[model samples]
Target: MPKSLHRRLLEKGWSEDEIERTMQMMYSDEKREKHAHFVSATHPVIYWVGLVVAIVGNLLVAVTLIPFLMILNSTQLYVILGIVGFVFGSMFNLIIKDIEHVDQTHHIVAGVFIPAIALITVYIMVSVANRFNEVINNPNPHNAIVLSAVYLITFSAPYFVYKIKDFVWERKQKASEGA
Candidate 1:
C-alpha cells in the first residue's frame, strides 16, 4: 500500500506542525489519490478532438436545418434541434473532465444547459444567416471560416468560465496561505 499523507510529508521534511495544519485544511490521502488518478487518466488530445467534433457536427447540422425550418412547424423544428443539441452536448459532457463536480451542479448543466445553449446558439445563427441572405446552400470556403469561429467560441465558453473560477480560487488560496 502507498504511504499515508503524514508519512509522505514527514519523508519530505515537512514540519510536524505544518503537516498537521495542512492535513486539517486538505482532503485525506485517499481522496487526493482518487482525484489524482482521475486527472491522470484524462487524455487531452481525445478530449479536444471530441469537443471539436461535437461543436462542428452540431453547427453543421444547424446549418443544414435552416431551409427545413421554413417548411416544418416551429414545434417540429425545435424538437429536431433539441434532439441534436442533446446528443452533441452529451458527447461534450462525456469528453470533458471536471465538468461533473461533487455537488452535481455541473452534471445538471451538462445535461440541460449545454443542450439549451446549443439549441439557442444554432437557432440564432440560422436566423441571422437567413436574414442576411447567407444561407448555407452547399459547402463553401466561408462555411469553414464561419463554423470554425462559431464552434471555437461556443466550445471555449465553458472552459473560459472554468479557468476564471480556477484563477480566482488559486488567488484566494494564496491570500489565505499568506494570511
Candidate 2:
C-alpha cells in the first residue's frame, strides 16, 4: 500500500491505463463492502418491495402499451409510442441500478432482458407505424425516416444495458470465486 510500490507498479512496464484498471478494481472492492454493509443493515422487506415494484411497473407499462398500440392510426400516436419506449427503457435502467449485488443469476437475467426488451420496442414501433400509414394513404416520408431513426436508437438501448449488466456480472462472479 506504500506510495512507492504504487508508483513502481505504474512505472515498471505498467501503463497508466493498467494503473487505472487496478484503481478501478480497488474501487469495486470498496463498493462491494459498502453494499454488503447496506444489505446487512436494511430490512429484507425493503429489497423485496423494491423488486416487486420494479416488476409490476414494467409489467403494467408493457400491458397498457400493447392495447394502446393496437389502436394507433395517427402520427401523434407514433410519437407517443416512441416516448413510451424511451421512458420504459429509462425506468428499467433505473430499476437495475437499485440492485446491490451481481451474480450468475443476474447474468441470466441480463442475458434475457435485452432481447426481450428490444423485441417489445420493435413490435410496438412497427405496429404503430403500420397503423399510421394505413390511415393516411399518402405517408409522410419524413415521419417514416424519423421513426426509423428512433427505432434504431431504441434497439440499441437494450444492447448497451445488457452489455453493462454482463460486465458487472462477470466482475462479481470473478470476485466471488476469489479470482
Backbone clash total, candidate 1: 0
- Which lDDT value does model 1 have at 91? 55
lDDT per model vs. reference: 0.58, 0.58
Model 1 lDDT tens row, 1-179: 99998999999999999998898668777778988978755644444455457657766776776666545554564456556544554457455544344325544544454445555656576555555444545331123234334444554455556557879999999999999
RMSD of candidate 1 to true structure, Å: 13.2
Give candidate 2's error at residue 179 in angstroms. Answer: 26
lDDT of 2 by residue, 57-142 (tens): 64565456544444555476557756765665565555455443544455347435643655554555455645655676535323
lDDT value, candidate 1, whole model: 0.58
Off by over 4 Å in 1: 1-42, 97-120, 129-179
